[model samples]
Target: MLSVKKLEAFYGDFQALFGIDFEIGESETVSIIGSNGAGKSTFLKTVCGQLKAAPSAIIFAGEPIGGKPANEIVAKGIAMVPEGRRLFRSLTVEENLLMGGFAKRSGPWNLKRVYQLFPALEEKRNNLSTALSGGQQQMVAIGRALMANPKILICDEVSLGLAPIVVKGIYDALPKITSDGLAVIIVEQDIDTAMRVSDRVYCFMHGRVSLKGRSADLTKNQISDAYFGI
Candidate 1:
């Protein structure tokens, strides 16, 4: 459903992504795994139109969307749950979730569905978002993105700061979230988690895809080599 062709991204004169190419199909979960400074986040930024990219670089549903504004990207059915969650601390849990509906995309995801996906969110709908625990806050972030009813959900470092049990709880909901054919792209530093949740995995090294293949087929040695640029 999405295609990237020879994508190169930069920060002024310093380029971050070097001719990176990737694809995500409908109902598929694709994970991007890499170490710090590996450009996994930059790849997502380019795909989501945060970084300026060549017009022909990113194609979504057969149309070139590279370099389009971020809002326009969300309107076109790509929503990002960025690193750090970035929830509105001032808003209540329900209000934060409501912000996602501003995209106005028609789909199966809605407030009710999101609550069902994370039942804990329902109990705290009226509480201040900042008052929630780290895991609960992460749930709110994901729920807020789902409110946009996006076709492709991009999650950057979803398990960044949470505990192991909490991470598992968050991941437990992924299957149901993707059950409705929503494509997902996950940028993760945890290789084991990425491989377990994704249908396919892309390992980035020095701003490029060093390895890409079926998640189950990649050996630990291969992933370790690619991750460390061996």
Candidate 2:
């Protein structure tokens, strides 16, 4: 449902992405894996409209959406759960989730659905967002994005600081999250988790795609070489 062709991005004179070509079909799960400074996050930020690109670079549902405002992109059905799970610490759990619905997009995701997806949030609906544990906070971030009823969900480092078991709990919900044919792009540091959850994987190096292939088909040797730019 989204296609990025020869996409390039820059921060002042220093370019971050180098002619990156990426695409995701309806209901597909794609993972982007790379080391630090590989431009994984930059690519995502550009897609989410935090960074600028040529209007013809990003095509979503057959329309060029590059360089549009972030809110406009969210309204057009793309929502991102950022690396830090940037939740509003001052707001109650419920109130934080409610913020995502400000766009008023119509979809199957709502407060009730989100609660069902992560039952813990329901129990602490009135608690301050920062009062929750790291895992719970990540759930809130995902739920907040879901509240926007997006067609494509972009998750950057969803498992960054959480424990293994907690990460599993969050990852286990992916099937249900994508059951409605919602496309997902995951930028994960954990290669195993990224490979397991996604149908395809792209390895980035030096601001470009070093390798990409079906997750199940890529061998350890190939991924190792590609991941480290061998």
Candidate 3:
């Protein structure tokens, strides 16, 4: 459903992604794993149109969409659960989630569906988003992104600040998401979680995909090598 070909990205002249190429199939969950500077985050930024790319680089549902603005990307059915859970601190929980659906896709995702996804969010819907705990805030973030009913959901470091139990709780919702035929591309630093949750995995090193395969087939040594560029 989404394809990125020879994606080269940069911050001003400081290039970060060097000819990165990858694809995510419809309803599939793919993880991008790498060391700190391997460009995993940059890859997602490029795909989401936060970073400009050549016209032919990012193709979403068949059209060349690289370099388009983030708002335009959402209109085309892509939503990002960004790293650090970049929520609007000033907005209430429900308001944050409502912003997610602003793309207005005609689909099964809505405020009701999101509240159902994270039951804790229901009662606190009217509270200021910053009032929630880290995990609860994470759920709000995910729910907010889901409100878009996006065809593809890109999660960048979904487990940055929570406990293991909280992480498990969020991951437990993945099956339901895939069941809805929404493609998920997760950029994760946690190798164990990434391996456990993904259908396929790509390991980036020095800005290129050094390894890509079904998660079940990659070995510890292979992942270690690809992760650290060993």
Candidate 4:
């Protein structure tokens, strides 16, 4: 459903991605794993339109969206749960979630459905966003992105500072999301989590994909090799 070909991203001349190629099929969950500075997040950022790519560089649902603006991309059925869970500090939990649907895509995502996914958010819907725990905040981020009712959900680092058990709880929810027919592209540094949750894995090295295959097909040594560019 999504494809990036020969994608090159730069921050004022310091290019972070070099001819990166990746694809995510419908209802597929793909993981991008690599060490810091490997450009995994940059890959997602480019896909989400936070960073622009040259025409023909990125395609989604068979259309060229390389240089499109972020909102335009969201409207085209792609939404991202960005890293750091960048929620509005002043907005209530529910308010943050509501903002997620501002794209107004016609589909199954709604505040009630998001609340159902994270029931805790229902009870504390009115609470301040920053008051929630890290995991809870991550849930809000996920719920907010879901509110867009996207065909492809790109999550950038869903498990950052949360506890192990909390991370597990979040991964456990992916099956439900896929069951609901959402394709997920998760950018994660956690190898164990990537191996467990991803259908396929792509390992990045120096702003390029060095290794890729089904998650079960990737061995520890192979992952290490690609991750370190060894």
Candidate 2: segments with Cα more than 4 A from true spot: none
Question: How accurate locally, in lDDT, is each candidate?
Answer: 0.94, 0.96, 0.92, 0.91
User: Each candidate's TM vs. the true structure?
Assistant: 0.99, 0.99, 0.98, 0.98
In terms of lDDT, the poorest run of 10 residues in model 2 is: 221-230
Model 2: lDDT of residue 108: 98
Candidate 4 clashing pairs? Answer: none
Best by the lDDT measure: 2
TM-score of 4: 0.98
Question: How do the residues 4-103 of candidate 4 rate in per-residue lDDT, one tens digit apiece?
Answer: 8999999998989988989989889999999999998888888888887896999888999998999899999999999999999999999999999898
Task: Rate residue 14 of model 2 by lDDT.
Answer: 98
Worst 10 residues of 3 by lDDT: 99-108
Worst lDDT window (10 residues) for model 1?
41-50
